[model samples]
Target chain A: MTFPMGLAGPISGLVCGVLFGYVLQRGGLGNGCRLTAQLRLQDWTVFNVMFTAILVSAGGLYVLELAGVMHAADIFIPTTFLWATLLGGVLIGVGMAIGGYCPGTSVVGAAAGRIDGIVFFAGLIIGVVAFAGIYTPITPLLGAAAGPQAQTLGDLLGLPAWAVLAILTGVAAGVWWFTRRSAASPAITCAD
Target chain B: MMKQRPIWNSHAAGAVLGLVLLLTFVLTGHGLGASGAPTAIAAAAANVVAPAATQANDYLGWMVEGGRNPLNSWITWEVIGVALGALAAAWWSGHLRVRLEGPPRANNSGRLALALAGGILSGFGARVSAGCTSGLGLSGSATLATAGFVFLIGFFGAGVLTGLLTRRMWK
Candidate 1:
């Protein structure tokens, strides 16, 4: 069910975006040291934060979906671009490792007055332009694998969505334990 | 207030973010996103320079589907709020200032160059995959999409690999 794009859309987006940004910054995602540590595998702050968010959203979405308040079908779901999505994920990960700013974090970083974040955002725009320019040539390769691939794990396994989400919650708990055990003695700081 | 206040616990922040995602979905029927706004801007720019080409191009044509103004999108408004919200948080926490983030051995130019390169790759990847962390990780994963899990795996793998390779950038 496609909703009409109107004032409410942008207004709600603004409210959510603001809250997202505030939490991200207050959560230390906007901290260069913490972000770098996350990539370095020394500090698991990012891991903890990101996975927890995923779990929360997953659980929330499932509840909403089941309650008939908002169905998953109504959300903006991504089509399974098998190769493109995976490859893009790798590239994004590598880029984050290199630049130390995730997509949303880059905006927060810039807002927090990090010059590097600003520069990275500029590069991101340029990259988008380039992608658009060469989109036609790459469409065939990226859009390959025309078989069924975008189904959810729950669908494929014939399990309820809530069950799959419960497993994820367990996984998150495991990660928390692991991160707790892996905490560095001094809590790694940014070195100049 | 030019001092650092201890941050909220990471898990706590994550939960908050998740609540926000739920709120957004409740209000708009979609999850949060960060890169789509940039994509919209790029498409809008292309439309201005070459109206026909933008409409004809498969990648950019969606921006104008149903005669929609890509610039007037939720992602744009959300991203704008992201910046403002971050600024507000920073100010409240007394962490709002410019301090170069390169290691002692690395200079400003080197760090900036890396930022540019990394940003470009990330942007391009987001476009290619059709979602960023917010779009793919939070929203897609929340929806339990297989592509979302695949993207998450690939993302972590590359991050670990590049982190090993680019240790000098931060440490």
Candidate 2:
């Protein structure tokens, strides 16, 4: 069910965003070194934190939907375009490795007084403008390689939400265990 | 000054983060985001400089149409909260400092320049993908959206590759 924002939308959003930012900062995401470490495979902090968060949210979301508190249909799920998303992800990864920050991190990092973060935010503005300028040319490419409309993993696989959640939970646990093991073995990991 | 506090346990902090995300969805009918703010800021800025032209642009026009204020967007308010909350966190943790962050091999100037370039690429890519790590990777993944997983694979796949190639700069 879509929550009626009315006049409270922005205020509620601000409150939620504040808590979100606080949690991220406390989670060690405000530092560029910690974030970039994920790229170097020297630290699994990002992977651990992110995976845990994903699982928690997924469990809560789908479970609630199952319990009839939330409706999956009302949630905003961006239309899938395989090729565009893949290419976009590649670009973002390259940028993340180079900048040590993504869009969200850059904003929080800047607030924490990181100059590089501020610069990245400025760069983001410039990039958005650039994309706007070239919007027409990029339109076709972005729209190409579209996927099935309004489908989720559970829907596509013909599995119930609970089953999908269980499977993903298992996968996440395995990945987490592997990462922890890799971290424990100093022989394969780079010096942080 | 109080000494800097050690960061929280990764899993504990992440659990809290997840709860926050869930609250966001429950309250707002959408997930947390970061890229939309910059897009709106850009649109608002363009409106000031080239009102008609900016409003006529294909991508950004919707943001400024009908004398609409892009700054009034939900993401804009949320981002403002993010900045404020981050500042408070930094102060509370005694980690508030103004400095450049990078490996020793990269100088301040080079790092800043790379950050700018990286931001450009990320910002551009987020638009193309219709979201960033938070928007697409986290929120979309929670929804079990296929695009989210694909984006994550491509993102991390290329990220690991780039990090290896740029190891000297970082390590």
Candidate 3:
């Protein structure tokens, strides 16, 4: 069910974007060292931030849905694209390792005045165009595999999405606790 | 310019970001996104030059999902906001300055070269994967999507492996 949003929609979006960006910068996520540290598993800052955000969003959305105030947007639902998800995921991972900035945080990095972020942004645009140019040629391999399976964990398990969400919530909380606890300790894990 | 202030605690930062996402969903009916703008720019460029090819390629054709103007999407506007927001945060925190992020031993040219390479790979990857850490990891997983979980697994696994292989770049 779509909520009744007029100017509230875009206004809230901008406000939320500002809030999110502010937090990311303050968290040092826009810094490449922090980004690479997470990859090395030497710093759980990225993990802590990401999982916690997921938990909050998931929990909030669940409540809103129950109240009939919110529903999933059609555009945000990632189509099945089994092969693309798998292959694309691997590539994104490698790129994150190499760049230390994903599409979102790269914006933060650029704002923080990192030359790397700007270069990466330019490359990202070029890459998008490159993909578009070659997309037709790989249709059989990439496009044909696209299907709208909905790709939710709930669908795969024959369970309600809320159940999987509950499990995920638990996992996020557990991880958040573990990271905090370990960060407090000097010798628990190589990563703090 | 003032010296950089220390950053916020990770947990606090993360939780606030979550609330922001929740607000976004409630208001706009969509979570935040980062890659749509670049993709749209690609489409706009194609339309300007090779209008025919824009429709020819199945993948390229998606630039106009729902027959809406790709360049004028809400997400695109939000990304512009992202830049401004980041700039505000950085300026306030004294983090806004031109600097290259890399290992100490690297020269400017080398740092730039690496950044470009990494950017190209990441840019291509985001397009191929259809989302990045935010779109797939945060937003998708929040909704209990399998693809997001799969993406997280793949993203982290590859990140670790690649980081190990290229440790010298940042160390």
Would you estimate the TM-scores of all the predictions? 0.91, 0.94, 0.87
DockQ of each: 0.64, 0.69, 0.57
| lDDT per residue as tens, model 3, A1-192 | 466243334556567667767778887788877787667665778888888788788778778778876665532556657777777778777777777688888888988889888887777787888887777666665654665566677777888867887787788778767766544444312111
Rank candidates, TM-score, best first.
Answer: 2, 1, 3
lDDT of 2: 0.83
Off by over 4 Å in 1: A1-8, A146-150, A184-187, A190-192, B47-56, B61-68
Give the residue spans of candidate 3 off by over 4 A.
A1-13, A72-75, A143-148, A173-192, B48-57, B61-69
Q: Which candidate leads the pack in lDDT? A: 2
Clashing pairs in 1: A192-B104
Clashing pairs in 3: none
- For residues A97-187, what per-residue lDDT tens digits would candidate 2 score against the true structure? 9888889999888888889999988998988998899989989999998988856887678998788888988887887787885534453
lDDT of each: 0.80, 0.83, 0.74
Instruction: Name the weakest run of 10 consecutive residues (lDDT summed) in model 2 chain B.
Output: B1-10
Off by more than 4 A, model 2 = A1-8, A181-192
- Which is the winner by TM-score between candidate 1 and candidate 2? 2
Output the lDDT of residue A88, model 2: 82
The 10-residue segment of model 3 chain A with minimum total lDDT is A183-192
